[model samples]
Target: MQVHIRYFSVYGSTQTYAEHLAGLLNTSAHPLEVPLPDDATPVIALSPVHGPVVQAATYARKIQGRPVAVAAVGMTLLDVAREKDSLRKLVPEHVARFYLPGKLEFSTMSTAHRATLASISTMLRAKPVKSANDKAMIAAMGTDTDRMDFAELQPIVQWVQSLR
Candidate 1:
């Protein structure tokens, strides 16, 4: 059971998670890219999921027909079953999925990401009272915040190990 670790991170949380997993698994962590090793080696991809983007999907497309496990890093939480359903069409149906909480660094984001978040925050704040979900989004995107915890990776690591 050979396993490979790969990752794509915009703000470094995903990379950190991948590196930790790599260390624990004693494997190398590669950045998600083409020209990957041609083998039946299963991949554990640590990627971030933003508003409408999920980095793991790109890797999944590139490695079609292979066993791929996705560890999604994000700031928001959603029902795992529902999230899996939403991503099923983009990723392989057999993919093993995991959701890991992520952090936000306003200063580290691209101008476009910052601008887009700001726009959404503005809209959310316009309403005097926000729903819990909206408020959570606003707070996460509105300020520089860190919620990353290595402990959060335990389940993902255990799951990946089992794949081996």
Candidate 2:
């Protein structure tokens, strides 16, 4: 089966995941800004935590009515996806979505992301989650980095392959 993994990544983790997934499947992935080929290849829309904002949804719509998958990477609570009503609606039916842990360097993220998070934290009357794990994650998220263990893609890859 032919597959097209098209993705948008603000911090690059999603793109890195897509590339690794494509390599494992022995198929090429596409850039989010590019046009998907007209041929009948199943499209996978991948994105980072920015969610529907990154136009992964718009890209998915271009290949709508075809078999497609949507996967997102983010700093998630273990069952965040299951609990999030908004995320449920954002991920389309033909789209198989999953989340992997994402770490963001305070310095590397766009000012908009940092500001938004800061605002959201303040509005919620909470400080950023200051767990030991969180601290380690952030410290490792050096400037100019979007590092992730490719193993996170395995479950989704196996599931997608099963669809063939």
Candidate 3:
């Protein structure tokens, strides 16, 4: 079976996971910006979950007719059920889904993200009340934090192996 891996990462955690997976699968992982190959092969896509949304879902329409599997990486925790629900809009129901935790380096964020994080931090710090999510985000306001683990990739590996 032919496998094509496409991924996008901001801080490189997802890219790391993608590379590791590609290494094991013995396939090359390309950036999502590159065009999907012309043949109908299984596609393994890795993208960071920004707001629990797959950032690379925008590529779904371009990859129709190919079997697909997705891995969503994020600093925030999420369950597979929610991910499945969100992923249905992006891929067919036959598409497999996986979630992996990723790190967020405050210094490595883009300007727009940094500005947004700063605003949220300021609001949460100034306000007497904060929601659980807000509190979590506030508590995580620091540089060089990591949650990614290589062992977390077993599900993805199993999915790919099943395909093979």
Q: What are the runs in model 3 whose C-alpha is more than 4 Å off? A: 78-85, 121-135
**56-163: candidate 3 lDDT, tens digit per residue:** 665654567767888778765454335445666676667786778788897778888878777868987888887665666678886666878888888777777787
Candidate 3 whole-model C-alpha lDDT, 0 to 1: 0.77
Clashes of 3: 0
What 10-residue stretch in candidate 2 is worst by lDDT? 136-145
Locate the minimum summed-lDDT window of 10 residues in model 1: 77-86
The most accurate candidate by TM-score is: 1
lDDT (Cα, tens digit) per residue for candidate 1, span 1-164: 56788899887889999988888878778888735677887888878887767888767766765678887787765444245545666677788777777788887788999898889889988998887767788878757877677887677667766766
Rank order (by TM-score, best first): 1, 3, 2
Which stretches of model 1 miss by more than 4 angstroms? Answer: 78-85, 126-129
Pairs of colliding residues, candidate 1: none
The sequence of per-residue lDDT tens digits that candidate 2 reaches over residues 45-160 is: 77776634535665665575567776767754435543563445665566666666665667777777777765644544443556543444344433433446678778778777
Q: Return the TM-score for each candidate structure.
A: 0.83, 0.76, 0.80
